[model samples]
Target chain A: MKKMLLLYVVVIGTLMAYLYMVYFREDNGGLSENAGLHGKTDERYVMVNFLTGIDYWKNSLKGFEDAAEALGVSVEYRGSTQYDVQEEVMVLEQVIARSPSGIAVSAINSEALNAAINKAVEAGIPVVMFDSDAPDSDAYSFLGTNNYNAGVTAAREMAELTGGQGEVGIISLPNQLNHQERTRGFSDTLAKEFPKLRLVGIEDGKGDQLVTEQKSLELMERYPGLTGIFVTEANGGVGAGNAVLQAEKIDKVHIISFDTDKGTLDMVKSGTISATLAQGTWNMGYWSLMHLFHLHNELAEPMPDWRSSDVPPLPTYVDTGITVVTESNVDQFYAK
Target chain B: MKKMLLLYVVVIGTLMAYLYMVYFREDNGGLSENAGLHGKTDERYVMVNFLTGIDYWKNSLKGFEDAAEALGVSVEYRGSTQYDVQEEVMVLEQVIARSPSGIAVSAINSEALNAAINKAVEAGIPVVMFDSDAPDSDAYSFLGTNNYNAGVTAAREMAELTGGQGEVGIISLPNQLNHQERTRGFSDTLAKEFPKLRLVGIEDGKGDQLVTEQKSLELMERYPGLTGIFVTEANGGVGAGNAVLQAEKIDKVHIISFDTDKGTLDMVKSGTISATLAQGTWNMGYWSLMHLFHLHNELAEPMPDWRSSDVPPLPTYVDTGITVVTESNVDQFYAK
Candidate 1:
């Protein structure tokens, strides 16, 4: 009888202990090491951008997915189907409505998505910006290439190509901060160092291929002696390449463009286009999620005496490095 | 007492059955549905290449790693530390001795490593060639850019750049079959399509940038009216670009270079190089491993009349494809 009583007590006590550990774990979240094994995650992160299918987003998205896999969490990709700022804003609003654990966004316009991004952070969701950034937003970090430094690199490369003396011009998007910064960097660098290279003018490509082509043609026409032209974006570079091809000025007027899109790479390979700068796209996606993960897990402590306990101690910006692609290593840039 | 004995027997048998199922599952490979759990991987695959640390191998290695992760298998990167063919042969022999599940190699020399590669096949290990191939060997498939077509593309692009009129020269490595094919393609294409564009000579660059530069200078000196030159490799292309730069014929001498290396890309960006050809390097590494995995798992079936049971019914050649990089989209080629 005593032995039977002991067996009953031992079994019941084991069951109670197991139940208590599970209950405590669920209540506290799996932040504790002694808590041991974890279950299928309740955490889901989302990446928001414009023109979701473009090759530009591929590397970044891969990084984000890799980070998600490493963390044993789920991730969803959301963006405007088209290249519209308003559409991206709507997408952000929709993503916020889902109330994901965290969000990483590449803003189409600097200020257009600020309200939506802020609202998510206000609702206790972590938001991180990548590629294109929104400066005024309450996001944890801006992870992307340094647009200004990219322009400076372009300027230096251009001087090398042009022998530090010639009439030069810029074909760029006028309103976008990234584009503007690139243009400013080029203009500033040229003015500061290669004083012999004169800036003819800056023409807005409007980030359209055909428009960039036409604008570039007009610039070449306006400045017949233009030795170099720096295109601030990928489409603009291709457009400029087309203009050079049409003009039969392949060897005369050097063209420096931005980004490593298929069209631009083709032009560079064919000799119609000059060189292009490639961004560290993968880093942006990987680190954005890492920042969000820390924020969501509350592993990153908030700044001392801060107004709220939400702020993550991540840096404001991450400068993903750039690579210069030319004829020699052009093959490496293609999808391997 | 008999009733108690029967109860004890039933309880012990039930516990033993449960424990038996768990133990049997833990012993077998995770191929069964009920044994759904996976631990630190027991499977290991490897990639072998030469000049292992060069930027050229980065995309291919990444693809191999990515495929390994997708298959829930572990992968190792191994290769000749230098660009030595004999070293590569030794590396292959060592890898074969380890008797890995499968192997993927980018052959440094066409026929030198055939014996080692064949030995691996004889040992019942699967082998696939990527980038530079050994066609006559026992390797299952070749995944790389079609060199002849790439040369033809360069020829056509050159014709367009030069307007089908001018004397052209080629700077290439004559010993390499890939380079030989490229040179032949360019010579044939130009001879057939553009009668006026004369091939003054094909000088061997010896796959050295400085040698290519010297040869390009000689070509220019030999034919002062030389309007276009085709370089059958990356180093040769950069050398040709430098020759043009020194000649100050940026407006007159058009250069068509092969491959996308940093120096060539820089020259192209600067308009010193007309264009470059980009290969699908990532596809080679990814597909090779994926193919090997299928072979290892017995997922790919053998051909009906094939001599060996080890063969996978994959294509003889993959033709990874190529892209043209130019100024317009040169930036896109950079690593983002």
Candidate 2:
């Protein structure tokens, strides 16, 4: 009898221990600690943009690569060599043919690339937009600066530089949606917030150095009291700075510009531009890849038929963010 | 000798299989399939706000609770019964004493709550701001509507409704930062884009229904040509709607309002208010918790000594997002 009792106790004891190990470990939210925050090495992602040769893409690409490294995945950077919508569409079509795990695109023209993006989505490939967006397309999310807010930031910074009182002008790419919003924001904030700061003239720079310089000169002549100027693009910033320098009005005029391109940063350093608004380009790249990974892996719970659904699994828009870069902090923006 | 060789081969084969399972499983992001997208049940997060009784906070709180549930965590909602800054500060202090996993706050005053927020951060707790923000505070991230952009969205909607023409007026809480930005956005966009849509007057609503109605009447009386009115808060929206309804000017005037609170939604549904701007309040709650979770779990790579560091581990600002709600879409916004 004693031997039989001992055998029963041992059997029950072992069973109890096994059950405890299987059912009672609650430290990891019901998941094994080793089961998260990584992906397969073969899972490939691609980023496509127009005007691929500009230094503007350096930070964004680095961010994409960094995210790929963190997630243990591979990434490729592809885009049209020229700034043509048709070329970009063709490149996207080719990328969709290979059907890399996912694609992040900066559309050259908002409406022109919808067909290609839609085709990729219909084929079960996930897509997200960055920088420039095709809003009507089926992209899961848009990661970029709120250009209007960027304009507001610039206006605030300009107020601080110009002591909230001055005649200001804008040199912008009027044809582009992003620049139009920026110009509106800068002009509006000035009208409402700084009663004394008058926006005198807005001239299109055509996004060219010489044209921007000419526009800056013309604006200065039209409003000689124009003590402040805001350039909505990097090349225009340098152009406006040159105009101010040649006119010997560097001290008399203050300028705020956009982006952290090397030329723009150099102007900021030399006080040709008082400050520039730097978009969260790196965040755009990194978060775009992250969003793509989540969707591709089905880790982010998508709404039922999310493309046609009222809501999406991911945030529809992620404001990558913006910061004001002035002489004090401009050095950190320089590429190492 | 053949039998001995067979035994050696079997043993070596078993060892190789074990090694492969441990080192080469690449299906996951180098993690176990069951790991990630979850957290511990015992971990608690708290959401703090100023007006605890208002309907404005319902969606945001729901979002916070939803995120907590998804993460296998618990959440507590706490706030001041009144709008007093001191009361909010004290409530936050109380929340800090308990040392929950993280805290999300919607600050009442832009500058008054900085010390309390910094206190929470100093105590080695993760903090994020949602909805309203104290920009100078040491919170890890701010997830809120970019009020300026919210204004811009409203302005565009107004243009669409008014056929980009006619006189419009604003009724708003001018003292509040959010409303000021909205008013500025509406007025600025009107002045720039809709040259024929003149912003004839701006009246302080004091966030009161009767007061707003009186102001609306005053505005309409003063500017007989006024064909549109934008109210920057829910109460004022309904009030403005009532004024138009009573004056029998519903057909002549279009109203654009802010928020999707029940009152606002009902008005939109009834066609009393032509449209309202629906802020990404839910996104604010969800992303705030996500940010705090990453910070608490050390999943987000923070700058060394991020408290004093110029850089943070996470994105500093996130524009939760915004959308337009008219009669056709107002039903979708009603809380189930």
Candidate 3:
């Protein structure tokens, strides 16, 4: 009977101890020592974009890596070497096959990448679009600059440079989503805000410097009163700046450009371009990874049928924001 | 010897069991059973806004409550009884005194509430500005519709309604941050985007229907060719609509306005107002809380000296976004 009593005490004590540990955790409100602000290092995420080697993607990549570090997770960067939509789509499929924890993409072609994005999401992998978006896709959210708003900023800047009274023209890649939105925003703002200023022409730069230069020359020749030009891309900005300089119309025509590439920044510094618009590229990368991490962990709920719902657990869109860089702020934009 | 051997077995077994549990939790990447998508119910948050009794605050308040529920945290709604800046500042100070986990504020005046906001931050309370912002304050984030962008949307809609050609005017409260941004956005867009549309006049509405009506009538009389009106506030929208209707120019003069207030909705439904821009007020509340939660838990790290840092953990500004409500979508705006 004494031996039986000893066994009972031992069993009961162990059971109570285990229960106490669990109860303590529950009482502490889910903040058990094991639960922290960190994730598993093995949990991996991937960021995919087109024109993989460009400096424009550097800030965004840094943001992604920073988020990975914060979350204690691993990340990989993969993209097409050039501006080929098919190649980007293929790369996305390859990444999906490897089945990372989540994927963040900057779609090269908005519609063309929908199938692959949808496939990944349907297979239970969370996906988000950053920098550039394929809006119609099943990707959960978009984190990027609102291209239209960016254009409005450019137009307002152009108006300021020309004293709100001058004829301005646009040189842009008319086929690109970002460029189109910028053109519309610039044209719309110019028409509604500065009645004294007129949009004299809109010519497609075809994302080529030579083409933009020729288009700029044609516009200048066609509209002698054109006192300003807005280019929707970096190459076009440089091209247009060159055209203005070669034609001796640099000072006479104020040029507002996009991006802060070395060439574009040089023009802004040299007084060839009045100013340029810089996007929140880094924010795009950081927020995209955060969103993916949340969705993957089931920490976010999409507000069931969010299409009809008033509010989603995650924002449908996040305008990362924009900045106006001119000669005064141009030095900071240059690569170290 | 037998008794001693039995005691050693029990002791060693319990130790191994405890060690195994701890090791398992760590190996699973801190996702212990106690860890979840929730916080302690005692972790409370507060949301403060001016004009607390108005219907405008209802949706935002609901969003705050919803987020609190999701996070298993307690929340309280507090604000000033009227659109009084000093009163709002007092209310914010009171909330700060209680030392809630966080506070979200919609400032009544852009600059008047800065001191109160700064005090909250200095006291170590995470404060976020929602709907309206004090840009220079130490608040960590501003989660709301970009008023300037909303104005731009209004301008674009007005141009479409008036066939991109007409004389337009604005009715707004000049001193309000939101109204000022809307007016600037509208005027800038009109002057830059719609070359054919002329903004003839801008009048202060004082947020009173009668004053707005008087201003609208004066504008119509001043510009005999006026074809559009963009009111920056709901009362002004309704007042402007009434003036156009009474003047027998409802059909001749298209009106684009702000908000989804019943008055604005009724005008849109009855065709007195062509359309109204609805802000993402709900998003403002939801995101503000989420940001606060992250900051309170130290899950986010705002880059040291974020003012000079290229990237901060939190976005400086979030354009919650806007929706254009027309006759077809007017019914949805009515409170159920």
Candidate 4:
């Protein structure tokens, strides 16, 4: 009887152990059975971007993340606390030092980041530019809103608003490449397309509200008949709006600005500003990161894939898009 | 002479080899001094979202990418081509099969994903929710906008737009948790704060243009005295604007929508729409990924360390922000 009882005990213990192995252990495994085939360990990559505290950059980062996720890789966001070139450069250096699989940058200064970008590429790290481009840098591609085209569109819209003939002034960030392109586009368009319109004065807002306000006030003073003001950047737009409000020129001084910040939208609704341009910011971030991930993982080759296929790999410069925002469609932007 | 020649050749060869080792070889090593610190192999992490095509997600992806870069790790993105739950779930399942380091999900359906999400957590993978969330899922935390508060603000703005007393209708996506919260807040505020204002109807737009248009047309028919219409999405606002335009109710009907899509802005300028609420979409995406990366890397503890008062850990939920976009500030949003 004792021998039989011992045998039963041993048998039960063996079965319990087997059940634990089959059920709990397998279920607890980190990798599930449905997971796809794994790639070689060496081919892993990560993408980096400047993400937080900036509205304009949201779309570009999304593009990057989407591409990275599709490729089964990783990405990161890093940048200056403020829009300072030196701070951006330092952040870039730190990112490069980390030797990420790749880097996607929106250059605050086209010239300032030349050395750091080159160093990364020289070290076998792939770099891509989005939103704002550094034309002279070693970064492989630029995916962003076509600033010049957007400018042309803006100029046309301005002409339509001002009845095709008026003295208009511009407040812009003179140093940034993207803003410079926009300014050029606006100027060239006004000169060529809108023959009746006069481009009177161009002022540097330094992308600051106070500076934009001061410059706008000065322009209104200098050109008393200034019919319209085009300001780039959110702060600049608010500054211009404030100038108009303080000057009590709501009806006479038409305003056009860049971005979709609250202050800009409010002015549009109240008729203090006429219209604004909205960029396809999401496309910039998404495509830039996608390009970076593909290059890093060897999933999609760099541009000049030169292969004639149904879907071309990707272009070096992708014109995301832009559109005019006006009061007629302002309700479409209100949060529920 | 032969011996002398051989001896000279050997000496020259030795010098050349030394030079190559010291300079040329080192230069051609394909690895820089910074590479050593960053070459450490680490687990991969990824985040996936629905509506991957939208502009608001860019910054969040950047934050994820930045964290991956800083951690010397990798990350990726995945999503449905459209805002379809089945497609998102398929993508999630595919990602789960690969068993990444961790996953960050922006849940489109709070309840539908519970099983799959739990499966991932059970498999030992950490899961975090960002932007829109699934509260019931095993996600560690929800990092996104405080949507309810945003709705309250919107309701207040609506009252102001309608002069504090009138009949208003809502066009909203009823199923979405975030939108549901927004509707609740808007309705609650209208009932509590604006005594003279009455909410005549709440219509489901399904977040589609034609559907929203149809819904708005029906609402207009039912409530001939409707003073305002609040739409929850950009496309919905456009649809509502079209309805109002077709019905020639511009002077009688006021519209408010969500997001800064161009269509909404255009309506705002044209006086078809009244205002919009712009959420800090960029911040939501950026910070969600940042927190996920930090948690995955163990760079910072899961919870704040009470003893270390120098740098506190990140909070679980972050209210990025909300802004009211109207004609008064419309010029500030135009492109430069």
Candidate 5:
């Protein structure tokens, strides 16, 4: 009778454990580390970009990190740290192999990264794009400024600065998708909205201040009557401003630049640059990770008709927005 | 007899425990965390800097982290994200309250931070300075480029760029200790060596690009024969470059800028600016941490001379060197 009692106890214990295991087993899509002590997780996310050390990405990275800190998770910063796209792809592939909980990428070339991004998605990793985007990729969402609208805003500001009737030029990096869109938006808006403002020339600044200066000078020499120059990036903005100063056209030529880096802000304050567009850089970084965290955790919850491809409860595109920074408010944009 | 035996056993056990505790107690200057499991020390080091988000600190911080990874310790980066000295002091005070194993600081002002730095040292924390220094403070060692020598090099490079005979000026942040040293070096060298090259003017750029440009333009206008300008900082360098470019003097004026930031390097490669000085920034950060780890851990050793002030055996000043980046080798300086 004592032996029988022992057997019953053993059977009951085994049954209890089996039931608990069955009931508590949650789908993780075969990823995610085992839950830590006290049912906590130590999942890590990553933010990727090219030219990672530039001031351009500082605010965005801070937002990504702040979100991670609030959620009790960890985030790592990784990137090409150069302008090269191949390096970005290689870094992405290596990161995917590590199977991070999520990835936020700023694509150097829009279409070149689709395959690598798709591979990460296929492996059940959540991916989001920020700052720059690969629109066709399997990224769950895109979080950044509406580049075209920002360009239109720049055009309107330029028109005001130049009184809408003058020859203007664009100093841009022609190959970048964002710059391409910005150039199109500026030219299109200028042609449509302000018919008298002529875009006499477009030159590639190559996103280098000196190159922008050289190109701006060439544009000026090419069209001596050029009364305005729109630099599609920060470095180019400063370069164009310099070119204007060199040509002794600081008063005659009005410059509209993008981004509120120290260089551009200084130019704007000094009236070398008439205006600059400040992107909601922090919003892009913060919300991308926030969305990724929710998407990553959603797999552990059950809902009818929940599909891997259909990540619900979050918008796929978030326009983080931008603001026009002039001398009047340039003080607000200084690093704090 | 039984009571006596029990008493003897208790006495021996207590003696053994006392001996172990006394012998194994390591001197950490009363600052380091308790040793971790299996004879490991979970020491944490911190690097404090100003303008925390700028690209200038990125390489140095990477070096600090790399050393920590190799040594199985952790490092934290904290600093004033803005160029504010009070903010830096506040951050340092907060870090001191944590009683980290070690601290590394880059002072924004040479004298304003002495009291705070000395307080950290007095609290038994190992403090080292990198990139910049508080020469009057209680920092154990300073690991950075010799600012005066770097300046002298810039002067020589500027002289060479201008073919030895031309009017040149300086755009510098005169209030900064390092910038002041650089300006002195450039001016002294020009007076002593480049007899034909006249130092026409020295206007404060305030380390802002636009300010530098304005100052540079004034220098040029004040001295139309100005064939070269020595910019003591990177932002100012580019600003001065822009001024020369805007003055339509790209070919006529030679710019000797400091640092290998992308802006300066790009200008160097495109021949917009003449050259830049690349500080051994990585070395400054890596060695500062490595030394701090040693200083913090040495008190635990049986070294008789190890004391709070003695700091024991490491050189107090480490000359982290600099390299000249011209068009011939500008490719080496691009982000890897």
Candidate 6:
């Protein structure tokens, strides 16, 4: 009886040991330890942006986060709560102060972010811009839509909508670099390529839905024969769509907008809006973080022109890609 | 004159000092110092999965990386290059050996990944599953689509498409956990909710375009009066659309697919596909990382029973959202 009891005790001890190692042991370098690395002071990547609340930023953030996970790193998202230049600048400054492994920013103001971004680069913190950009910043790269080309695409789409001969108006955010570029591209293309189409008015929507709607309504009133309207942002497009819908002028006015927020897509499906320019938002987020990770880890050398190289040898600004979303193809955009 | 020269030199020296401190100094933390933290670190973060090359994973990685960047940490993505169970197991073991910060896995096989996942959890590293999940694992959380519910939504959509009275077939990835759940939801609902809509056949597309196309063609041959086909993935939808186009059955057969890949969307636009279920892929990628970040940082406590507390309290399993896309709304999905 004594021997049996002793043997049972020994067996119990072995089982306990195995359980501890399997369930409670801290194997920091083991495969299990990888899951423990989160929020533990070792995160080395940061993604900066302007107005992080928008759906447009969501995919990009996912891309940034996905890359971070793959590389065994952590990331933080900091951005302006609103589309205020000063707020964006302040956020960038605070991010710079943290001295993270890397920084990816979306420039709200091209000139405002320049000094601070250069400071980050000089201090060895690699920076990459997305969505919008600062062309003169010392940042190593810019990962986002080729705004100008996208605008050109939008122009062609508008011309198509108007049958290449009609008066059209544009509602845009003039100060923002991407919007500015898109506007320029659209206008330039319309002028050079589509002689039959005349651009009547270019109004600033100020990136606000209500403002855009009001402005669009004003444009409609001002240009009685307006055949089409191009909106450079999601909110603007929806607002413009609403304007057309409310006016019951859907048959006469064709609206093209940017981005794919729920409201915008819904309008398109309902024929309130005609078409939209879809950017490679996923690519922007994915490549932006990838570039930041590489630069942060010194995995790649910085190109001579950081702003241009974000997309790398492709173009200073990567037209990650653009798709013309029409009712026929809208099913593809549905989330699966 | 000598005094003035000395004053000029002093002023110049002061300006240079300020510039160096502001612009050139390693103010944020030096990259070299952070680089050392990732080097030979005992803690690690591992992302495990099946078929890792898909675009959806890109955003998740970005989230993981963003967290790493902010926390000065590291992570690695390891998974099967193909949808193979054995390969996933092998990768999991390799990751386990390295001892990571935490593990975020998208289980290809609930049972196959069970032992390895349990091993990681038992080893004292927190494990979280994303995209697809292993419910039985000791994982702290599952961050991904509420696929079963998504399927129910798809059923409602199909009913709308076929006027609730026609036969439909399903194409799915047979072995995938999420797809299986989706199929189950869809099948159960069609039987109980829409009695008039009969499900005639189920085919395995293997999530390949060519295979899906071939299988859909065969289904068409077998069921000449098939009114609609539901594909649980993007490629299958595109493939099914192609088959329909080839068969010249566009008016008779309606195609509803999942996800928002360009190819699938194009078909939807062209009227080859009736509609698609767009998953909140961006949300999946974003929220997964947010959960991982919080879990790893110990910023938030893990829920006691993710399945139970999933909908309320913390929302463990989020129905990021799903939208029905058809030609009517295609314009809204377009980017401007």
- Per-residue lDDT tens digits for candidate 3, residues B1-336, read 577668767866876797688567545634433233355556899999998999988777777776676666779999999878888888888888999999999888778889888888887788888988888898887888878878998899888888998798988889877889999999999889899998888889888888988899999998999998888987788888889988999888988888888888988888888998877776677678877887787655333444343333466677677778888867766765
| Model 4 lDDT, residue A247, Cα | 97
User: Higher lDDT: candidate 1 or 2?
Assistant: 2
Model 2: per-residue Cα lDDT over B240-271, one tens digit each: 98999999999888999888778888889999
DockQ of 3: 0.13
Interface RMSD of 5: 23.8
Give the number of the best model, judged by TM-score: 2
lDDT of 4 by residue, A221-328 (tens): 898888899886777998899999999988888899987777888888887878888765655665565556545654342123312221122233545556588887
Task: Compute the lDDT for candidate 6.
Answer: 0.72
Q: CAPRI verdict on model 1?
A: incorrect
| Candidate 1 per-residue lDDT over residues B199-263, each given as its tens digit | 89999899888898899889889899999999888778887888888988888889988767788
Off by over 4 Å in 6: A1-43, A302-317, A331-336, B1-336
Q: Measured against the native two-chain assembly using Cα atoms, what DockQ does each of the candidate structures obtain, in the order listed?
A: 0.01, 0.19, 0.13, 0.01, 0.01, 0.01
True contacts kept of each: 0.00, 0.19, 0.11, 0.00, 0.00, 0.00
Candidate 1's DockQ: 0.01
- From the highest TM-score down, the ranking of the candidates is 2, 3, 1, 5, 6, 4
What does candidate 2's lDDT look like per residue over A1-336, in tens digits? 566556556655655664465355433323543323566767999999999999999888988887777667889999999989899999999999998999999999989999999999989899999999999998877888888878888888888888898799898989999999999888888888997898888888888889989898888888888889999998888899999998889998898888888999999898888988887777788888888987887655323454454445566777766778888878778886
**Better candidate number, 5 or 6, judged by TM-score:** 5
Question: Per-residue lDDT of A139-234 in model 1, one digit per residue for the tens?
Answer: 876778778878998999899989998899899989878889999999999999999999999998888999988988898899899898899998
Q: What's the distance in Å from true for residue B236, model 6?
A: 53
Across residues A101-140, which tens digit of lDDT does each residue of candidate 5 receive?
A: 8999999888889999999988888898988889889886
| Clashing pairs for predicted structure model 5, backbone only | A246-B246, A246-B247
Local distance difference test, candidate 2: 0.82
Compared to the true structure, candidate 5 yields what TM-score?
A: 0.45
